[model samples]
Target: MQDTVRRILTARVYDVAEETPLDGLQRLSARLDRPVLLKREDLQPVFSFKIRGAYNRIAQLTEAELARGVICASAGNHAQGVALAAARRGTTATIVMPTTTPGIKVAAVKARGGNVVLHGDEFDQAAAHARRLEAETGAVFIHPFDDPDVIAGQGTVGLEILRQHPDPIEAVFVPIGGGGLAAGMAAIIRFLRPEAKIIGVEPVDAPTMKTALDKGEVVTLNEVGLFADGVAVRRAGDLTFALCRDLLDGIVLVDTDAICAAVKDVFDDVRAVAEPAGALALAGLKSWAADHPGSGTLIAVNSGANLNFDRLRHVAERAEIGEGAEALLAVTLKEDRDDYSRFLTLLDGRSVTEFNYRWSDVGTARFFVGVALKNGPAEKDALIARLIAAGYAVEDMSDNEAAKLHVRHMVGGRAQGLAHERVLRFAFPERPGAFLRFLASLKPAWTLTLFHYRNHGDDVGRVLAGISVRPEEQPALTEALGALGYPYVDETDNPAIRLFLDGARAGS
Candidate 1:
């Protein structure tokens, strides 16, 4: 502990990293009913606290080690940190990144004079390749977490937090990837401020550290979601996992929508567009505040802000739902001109965020609708009850993952007599001709139906596709999908899809 403390105090990160401000989140404090502060690590040179550890690790290198060069595997922010740190030290970094890494991130590394090596489809594969290359080339491998010096380097953030706010703080939130920031900060905080809690945040889809803590050992995940690409690690670093397990008070697992909501909150309060992973801690903080409401001072570190401009559309679309400001519902009403008017009366002037209906000459009609809610869940529930009492069958689609992602933009449709129709969702790296290439890969025997895709400003392109085939073609179709080399989910049995894709009497 003394050695770790000494290393943190003497860490040579200031050469490339800045001591960012501890700023207040006004709107969030008012809403959460407590004083909320944000540790603005997003203000660093590389727009991430990663520069601290990256630069510190490089600083300790001997001239001979520097001459050998530095190599690392990162999906985004850490790559930029290492690139900038190497450039400042008069050397070039060779960054091995997953092919799925955002183009914006890949370009950032190149702009920093780092040689970019695009490798396998995910971070783990890229890291494996990097280690193999490191062993062969004899270049120094800069572990993103795991290393003691690197952990001490990141501990500087905790040093700054305590120095900046010496007053009482109920808890401090940190985002965990392979657990670099969380482990480093947790060690220092637990040592210095014994009463102040150190909590870690993780994406529910990629619970690297949380899973490790629960299992009492590190475990590799088969897959992780790419929504929060920065912290989407399949496995937690061995050292970091140990530190976080013993030091952190607890871990909070949040979903993508909650992350989107936190991004919106940061923007609303600080006028900053944090990348999904950057806002992760705040998302967890909100969950914590909700569960234990009080006037305690809470702080969450805004870890990074390397967001791609295109991804804002997705952030905006989900933010309302994430923050409970909007509701999505599937409603059935009698087919008539006055039906919508009657429905509007039931809403009592609440703003409608969306209304999608496919014109059909039938006795009843199904519509996908989005309504603005001022009272959040309570208002949403009340509205649903009113619609039901008025003879309008309603399905609240707010919490349905498929409904929010696809049905909102689904454009009402009733596919009739389509045999062996299968609805599937897929995601793949976005690049020139990527969509066309995927389209070309479809089997000649199966018919493509109900294809929906929109660019959500992510480096990954996602598509909701439906296919029709003969019963005999099922085996072949399944085999062909696996050959595509992209992860896919069978959405045919999803409740949201089943609701909208079921029998709709149209043109009767």
Candidate 2:
């Protein structure tokens, strides 16, 4: 522990990384009824905290090691860090990244003078290839999070936070990916500000650190979500896991909606568009504060601002629901203008964010509705109760993953006689030829019954597709989908699928 602290105290990060400001978040502080602070690590030269660890690790490499160059596997931000750091050291960096990585990040790394290798479809695959290349070229392998020097360099963020805000804090929230930042920051905060609680935040789908801590060992996840690609780790770092297990007070898991809400919150408070992972700590902070309300000081790390320009629409769409300020519902009503009028009257003039309706059935109609909420869940519940009392069937779709990710976007009447149809959502890598490759691999015997996809400005495109097959052909269908080499989930039983409604299900 002492050795790690010493390394942190003298980390050679200043060569490229800056000591980012601990700025106050005025609007957020007001809303929470406490002083909220943000460690603006997004302001770093590489626009991320990865710069510190990347530079510090590179700076300590032996002359021979530097001469041989460095290699790493990263989804995005860390690759940029290594590229910029290695360039400053007059050495080359070879970054192996998944083909699903955002083009913006790929461009940034290339612009920083790094040799880029786009390989595989995910981080683990890319990491495996990087290791093989490292062995072949004798290049120094830079692990994204586990190394002591890298952890210590990230620890510098904690040091700056303490120096900038000497007063006691109720809790300090840090985003956890592979745990380098959390491990580093927790170590320093434990030593310097014992009273300040160090909390780690992770995406709910990528709870690598939280799972490890819960199981009392480092364990590998079979899969992880990639919306917050910056922190999408299927496994936690070994060294950093041990450190975080001992130092961090606890870890919090947040869904992508909460993260999108945090991104909006950061923009509302500081006029900065934080990437999903960048606003992760703030999302966790908001979740915790909601449960433990007080006028205590809280701080969250704004870790990066490298979000692609195209992804903003997804953030904006989900942010309202994430903040509990909106509700999405699948409602059934009698097919009459009077019923629609009564529905509006029950809303009490609340703002309607969306309303999707088209005649599907003669006597009954299903509508996908979005309404603004001023009092969060309570108001939403009250609105739902009002609808039920008015003889309308309502299913709250706000928290439904399939409903939120796909169904709402494709609201319409269902096909009358669709049979043996399976609805599936797939993660399509955003690259040239990817869509065509997927199409070429599909079987011609099965009919492509329905297809829906909307670009969310992400490296991975979310696609909802329906395929028709005879019951005996199920095995063949599975095999064909597997051959496509895309991640997918079956949404056949989802409430959001209107095909499961009365008319469609009756025909099938």
Candidate 3:
């Protein structure tokens, strides 16, 4: 089967219209003192290079098979590719997608003339349902990356890479979900250009191919993160596993933040939005480029661009830390609070990128802090030095996996919207002294309420304060609370806020 795929891929059936542009990234290249080029596959028709494999696999079907029609499962770009190709070939295609699939993706599939069905909660579930439907209807099942035809079709991407770059390509970075794209491309590149390294990129949270490579066989993840929805497969395909196991050079796992940073960089440089999976290749290149320099030339394949515009907020939230523009932190000991404050003050120019405090009992009082750095390592090192000078223990939450994923999300040691009886809302000039002043202004005698603030390291900050107030004092406090410089609105008047705030009221 592998031999057949190798031969078919060698006899390319279709061609890419225009070779993607590759150029040095001034910011990145300057930082590493090496050449960096981005392969703009996000610019392709259907906004993904998936068209290459979809067209290749479907175009090879016999007339009889075509008459029987084709069935497949995909979240977005792949579904569009199959639908468009089948329409072009004058045949029918049915695409199955998860019920949770984004509306934009469903619309894209329909736009390509696919008979779309939403089923299950994840890709594997959709694929299973597609298989059952195919068996019942006798439609030819088109595997996304597992089948020989699919893998061979994907290999055409590798051929295009060598054809596009005149130099002795040093390394090629390909994104992996189920390993179909990575496996096929790696095998072909190894066969044609053995010295040109083939590296597979997978999301750190969903390391399907990485797990296979580690175990020497395919394995399913107990849980898979859907942050990079396009490439969040729990298990890799068997054929792809075999190919990648024997042919690939290395596996690079990128976190959500890195992918977001890559997406932001691509948009900044070329005004293109790379969906998470699409940016994986660039993220992989940026991850390993420093140590693997001068292998010849570096080529990264931008795989897909089926992105949800609404999800951009989540991506932006992480991109700051990915680019080292922000630092994440976890502090230990309430005794160190004073020392920590002094250390932070010494970071004069630097700002607190993010800070969420919550009660913790780790044998010591602690709070997690996230700092933003306009400058580089110097500022971080100085802050660390000051903390140590003050006889405080410092944890560089930047490199702590627990802090980044679990701790940061679990800020304040509790969930954000969880409520209580009273919310003392306040507005203050977004300045360094503002928070301290608020703390000073509040009477500790009163029990706490929900406190929420967004500090963009700016001049004016918005704060929501929830406190436990006696039922009798509520009306008088509401009328008199405006005396403070900041205006206060009684959110309890709003039904939703009241319900949430009332729930947050702590138990005696």
Candidate 4:
């Protein structure tokens, strides 16, 4: 390990980049009462810090060894780093990525002149395949963060942080996937700045390091969610696990929504988009600051910014509650139209962030409403009281994990008066007034049975709209909708939809 570290230190590829600015974040610093500094690794040449290790590790091979070329597995940022570094070193590089990896990442790898092979459905599978390819071709395996050389390369980041600040840093939050970055940073900090806290952050859905630490051994997760693909590692690397066990001060878990909120915050502050994993370190710091009150030097690594633009809306939808800026309520009315009117009136002063309603003949109609809150506990209490006064059963959806993830995607209400309904899949341009225009073209008295709209980042927006048609008015309704000249496909024949709706209704 020391030899690997020495190799890393001696590598000619090691370019001493200027230290990142540790400017105080006014909004976050004020919130946490701590001097929170953002390590702007997202501003790197590849818009990520992965290049440091990639270049360092590749530079170490002897002339004969370098002739063998190299192979590695990564979903995005790492692939770009290795590809670019290999190009600079005049060495052949091959990257294996999961088939599900985004096209943008694959394109970036190609743009950097790396031969990319799409393999497997997940990173682990792709990694395994990469190992087989390495064996077949006798290619040098550039283990992403596991090998000692890689860790040494990543440790440079810690060196830079310490040199730039030269202050009593209370904590440095580093994002963990396979524990490579965290392990490297932790080892350096533990060895040099013994008093500094090294907190490792992982997406809650993929807490490989935390799980390993809890088990007192490295344990591979059977399944991992890929929403935060940058950190959705199923298992920690062997060498990284060892370094992390010895060096890390603590491991912090941040949920997907919190990650989204942090990403949104970074984008707001610097107008730069960070992938979920990139923003995770900031999320951990914010979470830690909320619990521990202090004013000390804190650094959080902004790891990468290779996010798909299409996923922004989904992230935005969850950010409000994640940051405690909005409250989601599942409100059910006990009475008739009068009670509904009274409930709506109660929200006169509040700005409704999101409002979705579904009616049922079985009982009261349910409304999923999100309201913005200026203050935390006080606003929550007042809102609960208002719901109670208005005779509404309000179930807080703010912290309900199930509702935030699954239920929000699948569940909705039913309209009782619909004699006929037709489900249509429509693709319309996603612009400022697209939705309003669609509503304007619709005729009155035709009840909306179901509606789901999520942005896909393309000009075209996908929507599933269930239109209730009166038997006598069907012909005219279809004619009017057709005359509007929009592309539409009827999905009433889809077996999946039939089964889902039938099963849901039966269960209900």
Candidate 4 per-residue lDDT over residues 1-508, each given as its tens digit: 4544454445443452234555456677766666778888887777777888888888777888678888999988888888887888778999999998877788999999999999998889999999999999998888888977777777778877888888799999999999778877787777778999999998888889999999999999998889888888899988899878888888888888889889887877767788888999999988887777777788899988887788887788778777888887888875254454466568756655554554355666676666778787578878888888766788998888887776767655434454466777888665544545566566767755565655434677777777667789888778867876667888855665554543333233
| Candidate 2 ranges beyond 4 A from true positions | 413-508
lDDT of each: 0.85, 0.87, 0.73, 0.77
- Residue 273, candidate 3: alpha-carbon lDDT: 84
The candidate with the higher lDDT, 2 or 4, is 2
Alpha carbon lDDT of residue 252, candidate 4? 88
Best model number under lDDT: 2
> Which tens-of-lDDT digit does each residue in 291-355 have in candidate 1?
88788899999999998899998899999999899898889887554565678668887765555
RMSD of 2: 12.9
lDDT of 2 by residue, 254-360 (tens): 99999999999999888999999999999999999998988889999999988899999889989999999989998887765556567766888775555655453
Question: Residue 433 of candidate 3: its Cα lDDT?
Answer: 61
* lDDT string, candidate 3, 202-312, tens digits: 889999888978988789897778878888777799988988888888899888888998888777766778899898988989888855655356778777678889988
- In candidate 4, position 343 carries an lDDT of 67
What local lDDT score does residue 433 receive in model 4, on the 0 to 100 scale? 46
Candidate 1: Cα lDDT at 29:
92
- Name every residue pair that clashes in candidate 2: none
Task: Evaluate model 3: give its lDDT.
Answer: 0.73
Judging by TM-score, tell me the better candidate of 2 and 4: 2
